[model samples]
Each structure stands twice: as structure tokens, then as C-alpha cells.
Target: MASHQNLNFQGQIPGEFLIARIMQIHASISKLESLRPSKQVNILFSHLVKLCILPSSIDIKALPQEVQQMRQSLIILCARAESLLELEFATYLSKISLPLNDLNRFPYYENYVKLAKLEYGALIENTGVAQLKKVAFVGSGPMPLTSIILASQHMKSTHFDNIDIDETANNLARRIVSSDDEIEKRMKFLTSDIMEVKEKLGEYDCIILAALVGNEEEKAKILGHIRKYMKEGGVLLVRSAKGARAFLYPVVEEHELFDFKVLSIFHPTNDVINSVVLLRKSLIYT
Candidate 1:
């Protein structure tokens, strides 16, 4: 029965259809403002956290004011990094954090690793980013957005931007960051597809790509183009959605342009259905 269903999904979930499905969900959330405050907050917070309203421990208080307030209700802790905020998967947000079992929506697995102290620290250390400036992140939804904000503060050179192809994602990211006093004048937000990065290439020193779509060709195209955006010896951090690894793992292994590596793999101690991958990138062209 499961095999038959997987085959059915494979038959129907083409690239265009998958993109359209994402757009539809975006549209539904856009209209969610009409719902009651309780409902609105519920929906928005769910979307926000799922999209990665996280901060490293060191940067939590330094986060944009709006984002801090947005995260105020959630149960998160401070990590060793001045900018790092830890999400205790065993305590809160575990269900939404690890939604891999669900077939209809996109999920973030890195949140699961944030639950594991041993793995989380290793992931952060493995990033090899002693300093970061002019950071560019694709898939600025949840974990990536949090990372962009945290890394920007850690570098402190000013000028931070989290760019995404989804207008909804960009809008949500802006709303999340708009309130952070620490990020004022230091952060810029953009909504654009990663595929057209050539126009904006050479503007960033580091590029981070987190989250995976089901399409292997699209993923490779994204990775291949992202390197063009970095200066010589710049870094790229890429993480795949749990289900995407079956197809994407081999591609990452074969790709020569990126110094791709897994930073950490997170599995929710409370929820077996959810898992996340933290990976790092280094540009090889330089």
C-alpha cells in the first residue's frame, strides 16, 4: 500500500506542480490575517517558527526587536554563541519543528539537531566560519533565516540580507526581523529566486542554502549558480530536507564547485518522525 502511494506521489509531483503547491500554501497564509487574533497568532507563529524564527544563544538578546517578540512565546534557550538561541525539541515546538512525516508540506530538520547538544556544537564548529560578512542565504525560511541573522551579528561588519524566492518567505522574514533593534541598518531583506543570482553575483562573501526541494536538477542548478555570488574562497552552507537526501546526497558528493559537508544530523529525541541536517559549504573556484 505504501509503495503504491509513493509511486502515485512520484507520478503527480512534477516540478511545476510542486512549485504551485508551495505558492498555494503561501496564498492561504497571506489571507490568514482575516482570522481571529488567537487564530492569526497561532497560524503566524507556527509559520514563523517553522520558517526558522531562531537565534543563536549569543545573539538572542541582540536579535531584531520584532523577532524577539515573535519568539517570546516559544520555549527556547540560549546557546554558547552570543548570537545563538537553542530550541529545546524535547520541551517545545518539536511537533512543528519535525514535520517530516507529513507529505503535503515542507519541513525543517535542523531544528531536531538543535535538540542535541553534542551534534549541535559539532555542526556549528564544522561550519569553519570564523568570521562572516556580506552573507547571502537562499531558503530564508526557518533555520537559514535564523542562521543569517546570527552570523551577521557574529561578523559585525554590518550589511546583512536574507534573500528568498518565495515572497511569502521574504515577507515573513522581514516581519520577524523588523523589530530587532540590533539588526537596524545591519540587515537587508530580499525576495528573489536563487536561479537568477548572476545579476547579484559577487555581492556576498558567504552564501548559505538550507532546506531541500524534491527536484535534483533544480537543486544542482541552485548550487551551481550560488557559487557565482561569492568572492574568492567564500563559503556555502547547504542542508537538505530529510527526504531529499536519497536523491541529493550523490549529487553533493560529485559536485566539485562546493566544499560540501554535513555539519550535523538532528533527530528529535521526542519525535522520531522529524530529523534535520546541518551542512557547510566552501567555494572552490577561488
Candidate 2:
């Protein structure tokens, strides 16, 4: 499972090692930092643990037929690596300001997180005043960055609910949000499987789906639930992939369902590859 393979965020065939190296260094520093006292860092290795780096691109050619067949599994492994590394890095951010995290050097993972949140913010800001009342972010992981941004902006007058089935992640998300007074005042974390939350369906003007959620069956089930409970004309924003293999999450085409009409599609300017669909719930669900 630890076999080395060449992969890049843009599907570029870069034999480049920047992100891969950063992940290795991050894991190493995390361990090293855990051993030393913060007041008087170990003279020998203190600053070494604070290193950061970014990405570079390369070009290439055809993949073997067998490799093509295994692309999905390869992507799944990549997604898992990204999620675990991201969670670890988000934990690191807890110790200092976000800027101090040096987003450019840490751009691969951390900026991915921030842009996932900001993609929705761009839409909400354009929405008419008080139009975006209550908001729910499903599949919010340990950071709940999207919910934090919305609560601090559009949903400030109401509540921003972050729901996920993972209890540990929910707790971690709560701790992260609580650190910010404004986000804490408006954001709430709930550890409940989506199917069990009927009331949550109708409680918001908007719903943002996390990209990590699995297959078509699971998404269809959730969409069915949304059809039943979502308010008429409410917005449903889904994070998807347009032209690349994403980790554990399946790359799906724009949803073909009767309950929601495609309002527009948004791609992050950074070209992160995760596409967001802004949909409006149609009154009729067949």
C-alpha cells in the first residue's frame, strides 16, 4: 500500500517531489515538536520542524492499460493521504495564526481547505441581503472551514450547522470553531448520519456538500432526502471534480435529478479541480 507512484493535483505527469516531500517533513516535524519544550526549543532541531514548501509541475505521456484500470483505486489512496495530511496540518494551525501557517508554502493542502470554504462564500456574498438565512454544511470534517466562513459572513444572523458522522472529527471541528469568538457564536457541530436528520433538511436556505462523501448510491440517497425536506427554491451546492482523479471521493458529473435545477458551476481560480455546482431546488420532485 505504501508503493511509490507519480501523481499531481492537476493530473500533470510531474516526477516532482514538493508536495510529497512536504508531507514527509510535516509528519517528521509533528513528532519532533511533540518532544520538545516550547519555551526553550531544542537548540539542535527546533527551527527545522517549522519548514514548509509548495508545488511544481512536469509533463509526460501514456499510462499502461493496467495502470489506467487502477486509476480509481489510486485516486482513492491519494484522497486518503490528502485527508489525513490535511487533518494533521489543521491541527498544527491550532497553535498559531492562519497567516503564520504560510499558505503559499503549505498551499497544496491548506489552501485547498480554504478555497473549499471560499468557493461558497463567493456565492453567498452575491446573494441578496438576508437571503441566506440558515446554512448547513454536510460532511464537514475536523476543521469545518466552510461553515466557519459562512457563519462569519452570510449566516451571521442565524446558525451555521456543521454535521458529520465522524464523532472525533465533529469534536475537533467544534474545538477549531470555538477558538474564534464570532464563528463560535454562530456555528454548531452535530455528529449525526445524514439519513437520521430529517429536521435538518428543512432548516437552511443553503446546503453545501463535502466532496469526500462517497458513491452515487449514497449521494442519491442523500439527494432523495433533500428532495423530501429541502425548502422550495433553496440552494444545494455540491463539490465535484471536472477533470482530474480526486482521492477517495468519486468524481461525478453534474447531478441529473428532478428536484434541483442547475443554476451554475464554479471552479476555484486556483484550479484546485474540485468543481462546485450551485443548484436551486425545483418545486416539483418526481
Candidate 3:
């Protein structure tokens, strides 16, 4: 991890300085032919992630106007970095003859394992739902590791609907888990925008919104749709970010969650990049 001292913040928020570093990193990342598993791209992205997590006391909104203006662009870049990595890994895994039990050989597999445990623990602790019969993961992307880890390791009997708007991504996800008979039997991939499947939302006992699913307004719209259609008292695990991590991922605002009963909002201060918000659809919609 890059030390905050290296940036020389001098006891004040490095607003423009941080923006300059971000732009420099963006320029480097943009120049890459592909954000796949490469030493250069990995180092560049690691720097960007480190910059976002650097110790900072000021809220993201309080940053300079120039930095604030670049927040959305930063979020998009971060998402692209993550998506490209997943796509590359998924594509590679799909072509290989690796067994499902060997998935931990992937470099970033442990991150998903850690994240899955954190989320599953959060769900059980906050919602008291230790056994989920049906769960849906919105924007599961090319590599649906969270669902895979949860279904295989935690909730073995649960059925997971991995939803993504991109059919190619869904196909890749399906192929990645095809070797695992147990997982393949339990995981179902759906290719459609989340809003398009509002009628089927009520089937899931829990739904997880991925971090890169959408921007703030788009996420609110999706959340509203889920709130209106998901079964009463069903839990929604929303991946969010707080502190400096907000620049890497969109932060779910409190105002957008008025319709749902907000149960718990956890901001991880450790290696976990995403914060999790646990909310349950109100039994009585107002």
C-alpha cells in the first residue's frame, strides 16, 4: 500500500493535487491496449486504488470544485478497470479446463472470498436470514464470483440468479461455473436490464446490487423498482462506498432509501473496497 505520507498532504486536503494524480493515472490507464492481467496495468490500477483509500478527513463533497467535477469520471474509470479485469479472467477461465475447486488459483479469487464472507455475515447478522432459498445478484458481470463463493461455501442450498444486461457477460459467467456440477445446478444466469425483470423480482428472498451497477440516479431508479416489486420483507444488499472510497464507487444516499427500511450500513476500513448496506423492503409500502 502506498503511504499517505508519500503524497505530502501537509495536514490539509490535497484536492487539486489528488485530482492531478488521478488524471495522470487515468491517462496511463487509457493508453493501455487492454486492462487485462498485465504487470503495468495492475500497478497503475493499484496506485489508483491506493490513492482513493489514502487517509483523508474531509468528505468527498468538500473537495475542490475541480476534484468534485471529476468524481463521476473517476467512478467510471474505476468500474472499467474492474470490468476489464473480470472480463479477461472470465474469458481465460472459460477457455481453460480448470475445475471449480481450483478457482482459488485465480489471483483475485481471495478478494471475492473475503467479500463473500463479509456480505454473508452481514446478511445473517443484520437480517437474521441464515438460509436463503432464492437470491439474485444484479450486475453480476462476466465473473460472478460473489454468487459462486456464497453458493458454494456459505449457503449451499441457495439458488442464485446472476443477472446482467450483457448476454455475453452472462454466457461467460455460465461457462465459468459449468464445470462445477453443484454450482451449475444452483446458479442461473439472466441477461436483461434489472428494471426489465421487475415482474420476477418478487421471487428472490435477497438481492444484491453490485458496486458498478450504475451511477447514483440510475441506482436509485433500480432500487425504487426493487422496492416496489421485491417480496415484502426481502433483504437488499447494496454495495456502496464511504470516505475516500466514494471516489472509486458511488455512495448510496440516505434520501434514496426512504422507502426501504435501512437496517445496516457498513463501511469497511480494511482491504475490502466496497461498503455494504443492508435494507429490507417494508412490509407495508406507504
Give all TM-scores, in the order shown.
0.46, 0.66, 0.90
Q: Model 2, 211: alpha-carbon shift in Å?
A: 0.5
Instruction: Please give the lDDT score at residue 201 for candidate 2.
Output: 83
Per-residue C-alpha lDDT of model 3 across residues 70-130, encoded as one tens digit per residue: 7777788778778888888788889988646567776678777888999999999987878
Question: How much is the lDDT of residue 145 in candidate 1?
Answer: 36
lDDT of 2 at 258: 54
Pick by TM-score: 1 or 3, better one = 3
Residue 238 shift from truth in candidate 1, angstroms: 0.8
Global lDDT of each model?
A: 0.41, 0.57, 0.83
After superposition, which runs of candidate 2 have C-alpha atoms over 4 Å from their true positions? 1-69, 93-118, 121-131, 153-158, 245-249, 284-286
Candidate 2 lDDT, 160-237, residue by residue in tens = 788888887877666666566766777778888888888668878888788777554477777778667877777788
Query: Evaluated with TM-score, which candidate comes out highest?
Result: 3
The parts of candidate 3 lying over 4 Å away from their true place are 1-20, 30-37, 284-286
lDDT of 1: 0.41
**Candidate 1: TM-score?**
0.46
Residue 61, model 1: lDDT of 29
